[model samples]
Target: MNSGILPAAVAGFSTGLSLIVAIGAQNAFVLRQGARRHAVLAVVGICAASDAVLIALGVAGLGAVVTAWPAALTVVGLAGGAFLTCYGVLAARRALRPAAAAGLTTQGTSAGSVRTAVLTCLALTWLNPHVYLDTVLLLGSVAADRGSLRWAFGLGAMLASLTWFTGLGYGARLLGGVLARPAAWRVLDSLVAATMLAMGIMLLARTF
Candidate 1:
């Protein structure tokens, strides 16, 4: 690796870590799947693969298109915010519903199959505008300034995604049994709702 590549890699890793560390919809979904021990690998695989593709595209100059099209970002941000808010409300409702919450368990299929998990993971990763902004626009712009270090930076970002999703998908499983409790489920639901709402509000606030 070139001398400049080290800084680029570090920057990329930091960017990727910051974006993935947040408790977004995708991360929540991944954790839920992990808790269920259902299609965890597939979900992580989809997330990592999607990140790789997006990071590659960004590093290859697609960030310019995103930068030029401010309207696109606005539209995407609005859509993402709406989705997050709606999802958050649903989660909060579940949290508040005593009867319905009682039957909730940490283990189950969200869509009945690994294929569905893969598709859902892909949507969660790709459909969110924030993902594009973080991985493609921000990381790409920074990587672009690195000349020959761009590829290394992209690789580091990809690795960061892989590490996070993998850890989320597998690590959360350890708490599955405990989270399977009704009260625990309610708490988790509440947490997820709060996280989603916060992220949605933050995104909307940034847009205007």
Candidate 2:
């Protein structure tokens, strides 16, 4: 790495962490999947890869275009909000039933469930408007400021996404003993339900 690139990359890494560290709909989903210890690799890969793509697009100047068309976000917001709302309801139901929540931890997610999880992960990544705001516009603007080192900055940001998601997804397994308990699962599902519902409502409200 060039001398100048080091500083730019550090800035990008820091900025990316600051934006992504906060718990949101995406993080909540990732955390839940991690706790379940099923499809962890797939979910993390999708999120990291999606962020990389968005960062690349931002570096390519697509953020500027997205800004010009707020309507695009509006469309995505509607669909995402609705989907989140439904998912949240399902989670809420699981939380209410200790048996279902407990069963979730004991049995590995099936192939069908994995497919469902992958689709949900993709929706949570691509449909959430905040992703574009944080990864594309904000990161892109900061990278643009780096001039010649912007690509380096973008790479750093991509690394941040990979690092964070990998740690979050795999690290969560350490909690499997606790999550194995029914009460713990109920609490976790409850939190997940609340987070999802709140985010869904927030997304819908923003669109309006």
The candidate maximizing lDDT is 2
Tell me the whole-model lDDT of each prediction, alpha carbons only.
0.81, 0.89
TM-score of each prediction? 0.83, 0.97
| Candidate 1 local lDDT, 1-208, one digit each (tens) | 4677777787788777887887778998888778767898888888999999989989998988887888888877777777677778988998898667766553356566777678767765665787887888888888888788898888888989999999999998799679767788788788888887887777687778
Clashes per model (N, Cα, C within 3 A): 0, 0
- Clashing residue pairs, candidate 2? none
Model 2: how far residue 30 lies from native, Å = 0.9
**Weakest ten-residue segment in model 1 by summed lDDT:** 103-112
Candidate 2 TM-score over all chains jointly: 0.97
Give the top-scoring candidate (TM-score): 2
